[model samples]
Target: MSKDLLTVSLDVYLGADPVLCEIVPNSSCGDVDSEDLEKQPKRSRKASVKSEDISRSSASSRARHDPVSVLVKGGVAVDPSLEEPLRSNAHVLSELDTVWHVMLNQTNISMNSNKFYLIQLLKSDTEDKYWVFIRWGRVGYRGQTSLTSYENKLEEAKKFFCDKFLAKTCNEWSNRSSFEAHPGKYAIVATKFEVPTKKEEVCKPEPEVLQVSRLDWRVQSLIGLITNLQKMEEDVLQLEYDASKFPLGNLTREQIEEGYRCLKDIENAINTKKFDAVFRDSVNRYYTCIPHDFGFRAPPLIKTQEDFKKELLLLETLKDIEVSYKVLRSARESKDNRAHVDRFYDKMHCQLHPLERDNDEFKVSMVSMYLSLGHGLTHMFSMEIVNVYSVYKEDEYRRFKGSIGNSMLLWHGSRVSNFYNILSHGLRIAPPEVPLTGYMFGKGVYFADVATKSGNYCHPSNGKCALLMLSEVALGESQVLYDANYTADKLEQGKNSTIGMGRKDGVRVPLGPLEDCGGDGGRYSLLYNEYIVYDVTQIRSRYVVEFNFRL
Candidate 1:
């Protein structure tokens, strides 16, 4: 099989970085020769050989000179005729040298400005479209070339760009509205080209186009901004990192802060303003800045080998995850007459409270254990098989999983609501949530888990548990109404108003201590507070559970 790729289509996924890009004949960018490419596997094998063999013998290689490497001191670039100063066909390959060359020739600025620098996700509200800044990279950009009119005809162009430049499918996400545009400080300039391959051979290139969408003006604007910002950010970061090598650590803190202020002043002077409100012309001006390396030519846009190494690690991790998913899928499909498919779940390794423990390991244990309880899979054994087959790409499935744990630990879901409100009730045990979705797994409240979401949490240890807990909540607030630290063994199962009766510490607390006083069950929001509101409409027989609060 061929190796998987770390696509530099529009943005980076899983922290993977670009090792090299080539400006080939067609609209496509063949993969780089980085070692990390070997990490992930793909369905196709020798897919690149057909193209590379012809490329090595062709005049194109002679024309571009080096095929595998470049002698760029700053950033990589191509011939004006070969590169198309307006839009460099992305087939050409170059090294970090090209970025350095741009800085050396473009500006006369020092980069050691003192100040606190930070990296933040560009919001749709930001006027900037570029997520990247390149230095010695390609000097020009591909603009709105999707030949679609202002009407819905943009679909053809959109598909073309997806296949050529982005490789993105429109209907893949639940939040289809997310791809829509917003005002931003950055600008993007890109295009998509389709170089159809002859049936017998797939190695040749034939056509090129910009990645812009023809559907709506807003879509066009968004694509443009993404391209522009990517190029610009690549350049800016290249210079910034390079400057660090010649650190003037001897400079006083005040001097550093002063330098930072000066840099901010420069930024303010760079025609920076809100863009989502305005249109067209402003975006064009932004494109002009793509090749401008801060107007300050430098010693060199420096980079360390370590940066690439980290990128390799991320790529490898992605490969591992993909492999695991495949294995799990195969096992799942092999259903037999047996009631359930069983797999080993370790216990002894987790039970030991090791002396020479680590922090990450500790975090994993706490979270894993907590999530395990949600599924009613609590005991620490070497391994055990259980009924957890419904692992697909569904939010309800995850909700079900988390609910399973809550039911195991607390008898039933604390409060019944829609999928979102239910998950929000916090039966999960994950890490922090930077975004509601699409981020590293953080501490979470589960009872809403079935391995959905763009990201997930993995234990840092070889095997460990993560703790999950909920506490009594007051249902008065709008958001989270309750949190209880109920545990196993201490959990008292209840059947209607007769809950927790006769058990040692089990006193039947009214479902709604405020509204119904000594109430029956209907709809109740048990926020993590004393004030409970119970509305009993129709009381039916269902199971209730409570947990041990022992630390």
Candidate 2:
């Protein structure tokens, strides 16, 4: 096997960072002078090898001078002759009707590594030339690049590309849809790349007709709170995560799974009440697995259970943020220089219809009921309903309707940054890999009867806005719990969900007309009533309410 192929397999699949080394030609492979190699920097040595390869393989004078057609910063493989700017080749590829790109990642905590490999097949617009571009390195580093040109031989370039992919991943490119990872091979990373739309083809939605004009003047002030793109953008950006720190702008599935394991270990240590050296080590390992940009300051250690709980919540938010950031990054690649939020909004799979304050009776009722539920500490944060959007998610509703029986609308809230994925995929049940300790009612989709109870989950503070979803939860047969049950997924026969009873009840009952919870009204120690459904199919998203919190 060639050294390059071996290196690709190890670096790409084994989660090892690509080592910067000189690529010696086959002729001089066995006769390397250690002293001479020591005299030159590794980069200079690689450049010289690349130059030699180009000069020896090509007859063209232009190819000899501008030897390596390396992938530049923006993932664009520019032929020096074309002299194109360092933007994406997405549009150019679209015009050629040939866009082939794949991302692969492998992160192993045991190996202490996180790595990514990006490969693309580019066809030159000016000629019948083709280039197979490969970039591989550590997750946060620019790493290395190599480009191979097939002059007027597209078939040869394609075969070479597919062969390289097989060699690295042990999976055929054509059969990628059913891709099964070999014991030690790179996992395919799914990414959404948007093709640049022509300005004429872009169909911007027409502005909504004002319903307030037809309403009484007394209710005109409520119209000001309707969500616009600008306000949504402001609220979403408040997450303030440093995407630059994460070159991929998201964590790999493997990395996220590893994070769960790390958190589970920390959770065990916390439960044991052991703040020993081993506990400290576990904390450090968690941070390493899930990197956080704490700026210049060192990350604080999780010395308390409260701190651990906060970390768990942070991990949950980070998982959702990853989805939103990935979409935003792909949006950044488009030629359109529009605001990131506008681009992100255009990429959502589900439709969001803004509800008018004056015309939408449902919105008015929801707002009134939400305010009425504020009792005790829930009333501390003065809530203002900014916008209410009817979520038209057909797929989630289809799956939810499959399960028959008692269904009631309840509240679910999350960070504003998470809305992109939540709207796209609807509410999700926690993955089996996630630690049970991360949730109070085990791994399930949680909802609240009281709007303010779920509102607290938004982590709302003064001058900031948050998002809440009123979802229709199908509780076929309920298991009412007065305390935390980590293994609540083991529902009693015929029970579809778990309802955690609280000491205090909501001012009003559930919004929709649904069957009664056939169980006795036994009280729990929880401050708020929480409903947890183990299956994602039991939840249908209804309205997304955006609200501001004031002290």
Candidate 3:
């Protein structure tokens, strides 16, 4: 990309935060033609002679009030002599002992120019020197410049922040108290603040420090899981996988080991119950500097288009589900049905359709998602008859969150709807072969109705759940036994022996209100000691099932 078209981000350590007076960027740099910048409006400068000018500008119009801000000072600090060097783009690194307060265009600079090098900030909790960088090159600009230039600039910029502003030895205050955490390993930057300065009399209040009382061991496990997952990226690239597969390994054992070490370093903070501390430290080390004395910031925007729109929605939904599921399971454990659904509309809103087109991988994922979620909710909500249902539920959140994007796509495209259609068609409409799945109860109730999929539910009758299992049979074609004006004496075919071939095209039957067999409910149904409807929709067979439990 062309340098003119390039965008830069700054990582600065702001000791005071946005509460302080905004500092205008330096007016000059070591390189670049000051004459040109001086002659033209110092667009990089936040301070100006007029209020109207600020409003007129669009992108950088918003004045930033960071106690510490890094300025990009744009377009290569022009120096006539280094024209050749800058044009050729030779790598150069240097540090200046003098306070970088004044701009090369000193006549225009008003604030203390003590800060130089485009990026400067006091260390967090410690005082030390930290480095900020000026990465200039073309990105996305259709120029002859090599792509590596952009990458190189980014790498240098990253290094500058890591090495300088975040000097490991920095103290709480940058004035003098900076010190290294380890012996012999001095902080990348020298200590700046140790004792109070005379000028420091009144101080602004700081927000209450965020704290972690207990380490959620899950975090460590998750981090390790993610770290290991990288190893499988390339390996699984060929094998189809989605967010659900993020924890899978993608690399060799050695690389995985290295990744684990990195994960541990990151994990240690959480394990030690110091999440916010580590996070803030990293912020100081990485995000404090502004680029080129302007609004240059670089942070990976992990959110996608859909993510932005649905993140809050999904987050709230998840939270609600978690809470409600907890309550529902508790009520069941206590054998109470008082846990009425909260925000019923919200739950309804979550109902999503599946993809319209063929998405085999997505299809498989939907299958898993539905089954898992169904299983959890069923197993947790009801102690009995949980096994009678074929649907499963789960919130394997980590896996789901990762796959949410694609799964949502499928959901949007009617894939979700289609899935339900399949089940409906097989069990309630018609089926070639009876569908059969293992059932269990009250183990992992998550977020599904145990007795029925039909939203229509009645309060439990005593401790027993009343559910209706409707089985449909197509005349002569369906395997589910039914009594729809047909002969009742056929052991030749059908799921239940009590019923017989129906003259009608289809039929619905209530399966169970299973009376405890190590559970609250239990019941068995078969035309010939076997379920005849295999699955819904996918198979165009004649039999379907309609199961209803008054639950």
Candidate 4:
């Protein structure tokens, strides 16, 4: 294929609108300068490809090809010559019913493979027919496709679809809500869709709408944050790491392990006063294991402890990017690709309701405390509380408050990309395989009494937005610590939680009349008040606040 023609093919494969790239017949895709092509807009350049010329070239290039099936409107397969029937068929199936659609992803960092499989079942609107379409391949590529037709046999089609889903995911389709991932198998990826509802529109304003409009301005800000999923997705995508440097846009588990080991060695070297050859070798080893794309410029060496810490953080960020990229690829490959990220929340079974700015006493107290607590050491940066939202997870909340007491709302924050899994699975303890160097207080769900302390974990830089969650933590009987304790998870006999005593005080007033457990009676002095819970059931996510930090 010609250079220009190849670009067109890539564009089509990447889910660009084909209608915009109208191909002029009997024309050649002329050679264009590389520099000039780079300057031109992508849409403008796509129009230059000659469809007929490329089609003929592609046909001549292939050997022993199967019967070509062309997909037209309404996903109906037709012969190229019988184009007239497509219009009528599409019109008939305009309101086609979707029986089922699933997108699955399997990423084995150990094997360095990231792939996606999409299966869809659709029922004909005008006829007794069902279509089963399946597509599978490495992400960011067009991949292979198969279309099976079941004439007047909906049961057979459904069976075929379910069988395929089970074969790929090793999980029953009916029990997908409780999805379990098996070794060396695809995991069912959760996706959200905006299906049109058939409810008749009422002329009068909804009580909920009136209630929301009368909320306090601060509460309104919180409402805006929860409702604006589009903005949140954009912020998450902006938190990108360079994936193009890795093989198939995936970081292998081996690479991650090696990177962590290197960081640990450097940390030890710094403490032992061996920052010469030992530190240099560790730094070199890290760069070798984790390939970075520095282009023409020379890659910098990690010389100081601060630099070593930054590299360690980068390795962790890469892991998050790998996960977010796979989810994004699966969403893009599906038929209904609109608002894919926003729909992720629906798949996780987590609901976010905006707190009333005016009438909600809880919102008023929470916002007031959040703003007022911005004094002392935490008040260095200007804090803007963008939105406040009440989180509801039926199973977690119901199971959480069973025998727990002395609950107080505290702050938790994480990177935007991590929220995809964080909100889905709730906060999780680090597995045995993960490195312990990053977790100062060990593998547990950590929270903070001060917003800035938790907000720092969001890693906000360059004026980007970050997400923070306030959860009702049941810290019944806590063990106090001032220094790092790697084995903090091995709690003593009766302690329900661990409190890291900090130098600064949190909220002066009680956070919503909850029983206040004052700081460690000024016994130990740490930087900030850190709350760590070993059990996941001891926490109930209360509010998620999105805010921007201005330097």
How much is 515 displaced in model 4, in angstroms?
17
- lDDT tens per residue, model 1, 326-425: 3333433343322111210010011112112254455344333433332312212221111111112233332232211212112112211111112222
Off by over 4 Å in 2: 1-244, 247-250, 274-278, 293-298, 328-347, 374-379, 507-523
Ranking by TM-score: 2, 4, 1, 3
Query: Can you write out model 2's per-residue Cα lDDT over 39-90, one digit (the tens) per residue?
Result: 2122212211132111111111101011222333222222222213311231
lDDT of 4 by residue, 1-551 (tens): 34433311111211121222323221232111122112211211121112211112111111111222233333222212112332123211222243276666554332334445667665444555655555543332223344455556767768878897887778998788787767556665443332323312111223221112334455444333433434333333232222211221234455566667877777777667676765665654554455432322234555565665566666655555445445544643455433434333445577777666676877756565765463336445655766667788887888795376778778888776566556666887865645565566778999887777777777757577777888888888899888888788889998888988776656623542212245554565566678999999998887777778777
lDDT of 1: 0.21
**Candidate whose lDDT is highest:** 2
Model 3 ranges with Cα > 4 A deviation = 1-551
RMSD of each: 24.7, 12.7, 25.6, 14.1
Worst 10 residues of 1 by lDDT: 343-352
Candidate 2, poorest ten consecutive residues by summed lDDT: 55-64
Candidate 2 pairs with clashing backbones: none
lDDT of each: 0.21, 0.55, 0.23, 0.54
TM-score: which is higher, 1 or 4? Answer: 4
